[model samples]
Target chain A: MKYILSFVLNGQPVDVLAEPTDTLLDVLREKLRVMSPKRGCDEGDCGACTVLLNGEPVRSCLTLALSVAGQEVMTVEGLSKNGKLHPLQRAFHEHYAAQCGFCTPGMILAAKALLDKNPHPTREEIVEAISGNLCRCGTYQEVLEAVQAVARGEYAEVKE
Target chain B: MGECIYFAPTEIGEAVRLLAEYREKVTVVAGGTDLLPKINYYQLKPEVLLHIGRLGLDYIKEADGKLVIGAATPTSKLASNPLVAERASALAEAARQSGSAAIRTTATIGGNLANASPAADLATPLLILDAELLLTSTRGNRKVAINDFFVGPGKTVLEPDELLIEVSLPHQKGKSVFLKLGRRKAMTLSVVNVAVRLEMEGAQCKDARIALGAMAPVPLRCTRAESLIKGQVLDKSLIDRCAAEAVAESSPIDDQRATSWYRKKAGTVLVARALARAADMEG
Candidate 1:
């Protein structure tokens, strides 16, 4: 019942023991201890467990670990480089977007997926992109602003 | 709920062999957007999981004027596929409206059909598109009309030894419309969904198909409604009557998303809207 799952985590290659039934979220949080992605609804109904699978946002909770064998996966912890927080994180801090902060990781990753595809997304586009992520903190307006700030060229150098 | 073994086969022949070898001990999981939850929630427990993820089943192809969608083709692909968007706009729109971005990205069209949820967004459109499902086994392959694929909710006619390989449809030659009324704007189950496809000859409805979801134990084609509109020049009076016939085809039960009474009434309205939109597409 045990299988070895190999994937690129952040920018490093990782090989981890996994159960075929175990989800990527389970392995990432428990086995790998890369715990930025939160488990809100075990079902795919909520985006709390959203992570980047091969540069596309997917619900980690719904993704089987076996399915992700030899693929690239990214979580919010991987966003920062050289000890500098990603612009979306910095923007969230400045905009006060995190109330309870539980949803921040998923929110930032979801927004990053959008910004990666569309560097200069419109306000509506930003909203639609993060629509899957639910912020019970009622910080939706501020989250919108944080994503909008990143799109407004507030951190152009961050892309490099 | 218990320990399970998973098999990942890279070849279709190997996959078919595994299915035959394992039989009922195995369950096929492609997207796992639906199956994983059931496993986690203890709704389903199979000793072996036959994962088709690595089988290279994720594909969209055009063969002999027919659009062939692989069993593992993600919902996101159908939503934005240029060929699907142009030829089968209703299905594309249904894909676009289903679940959310993450769900669309990971969920496959085959999983949507195989799960056989009555509220499945893609099923109604696929039903109206006259889609055919191809199932394969060690014995050979067989084609089943999408219309006859579903037996009941959360059930399909797939045998334990058979795996759905492809879904095919001829280029839709009609103006089509899809309407889904969900509890929320996104990531919610449809209360009532309707798909209408009209083949028009200068405003006269040459042929028609009306499919409704969340209206019965299975997604249904409104043959009576199609009969009313077929060969008739659609107008306000005929459209109204056609909508009524579509409603008559529904047999829903009360559930968390909606009540039978509300669905009975809303089903008619959604069908009417879909037909009206299809007519406008002709205009």
Candidate 2:
């Protein structure tokens, strides 16, 4: 029972054939070939598959693909516009936040979701926002620094 | 596992009709926080995945002197809702600490209650608050007290054709608090969680309700412990005795998170702490 699942991916609309059991992570990485969101854990424990569903951070691995029909999903691939990185992405690259790069995509998107809602989040809020995403390389410190730098207006050039 | 039909009905009547038609074969998915993981692991392969997310059940309102929460309402919304925080502080705290921010965004109270985990974070607070669950089917509707909802671990009284539509909490006059003991701060299941509500008249306790989670096959109300505090002043010694008495009603078991012996010890302390916090006697 494959259905045509139509949803807004990033800023564009997309329709893909998906099964009832297919997860959002599966459709994004496999069907659409959007490789930003990682597949570290098929379960929801590891937040490697974190993405923005309607501007809120959610575990795509645990999200049913059919459930997200007609909703908006944003990933790390959609952050950059005209080859210019989003503020969070640029800050992560500059602050050495990507150790293994496995959790970077989810981490950055989670931060973006936070900053979008709360443009200025405190250190604790920043930590709590990305608490679900686990960085196996232990780059939490650097990730924290990167998110803090953005919060402190260090990367004020690129608003998007 | 091969072929499946997914139905995302927009209306509640339509959803219940589908559930009645599919019966045991339909798996109702509200948040998909718990069900998808089981589906991914092949632990549950439903022939019909009935998504109730779009059933217009994500809401919170007050009616008939009760706080009515829609079954599909997410935990994050509950945690931040001003009415919930003011009226049911224990439930708000429990919702705030249920899971990580991401999990809370999608996880629903109905799904958590339906899943019927022994350590369900929402269960303790709801139990202490004397909440009632409204279960609906194509035939009719019935309201069950929260205390009578759970049967055992991963089991509830919900029939295959019935759907939990809403949870209604009557206005209670008490200061309540919730405390959870987990392996870690976030994204961890509770080893033991306690919720205490105390209706205090100056120094003497007017009424008390104590609920403990992960200390039994289901979330349990410590009737003996609660009765001990009624019409009595809650002092240090009395609180300790009540805590011990509450733990006596539990039949915890050794699992990956904790041992039965350890749960009794830690649950006693946790209950005492929650009682103190609820009574505003914390030192």
Which one wins on lDDT? 2
Shift of residue B43 alpha carbon in model 1, Å: 1.8
Which regions of candidate 2 fall more than 4 Å away from where they truly are? none
Candidate maximizing DockQ: 2
- Ten-residue stretch with the least lDDT total in model 2 chain B: B181-190
Query: So what's the TM-score on candidate 2?
Result: 0.98
Q: Give a tens-digit lDDT track for model 1, residues A1-160.
A: 7888899999899999998789999999999998889989888876888999988889999999889888899998788998888889999999999999988888888899999999999987788888888888888899999889889978555644
Write model 2 residue lDDT over A1-160, tens digit each, in one string. 9999999999999999999999999999999999989998788898989999999889999899999999999998888888888888889999999988989999998898889889889888888888888888988899999999998988886644
Interface RMSD of 2: 0.8
What stretches of model 1 exceed 4 Å from their correct place? A158-160, B281-283
Model 1, residue A90: displacement in angstroms? 1.0
lDDT of each candidate versus the true structure: 0.89, 0.93
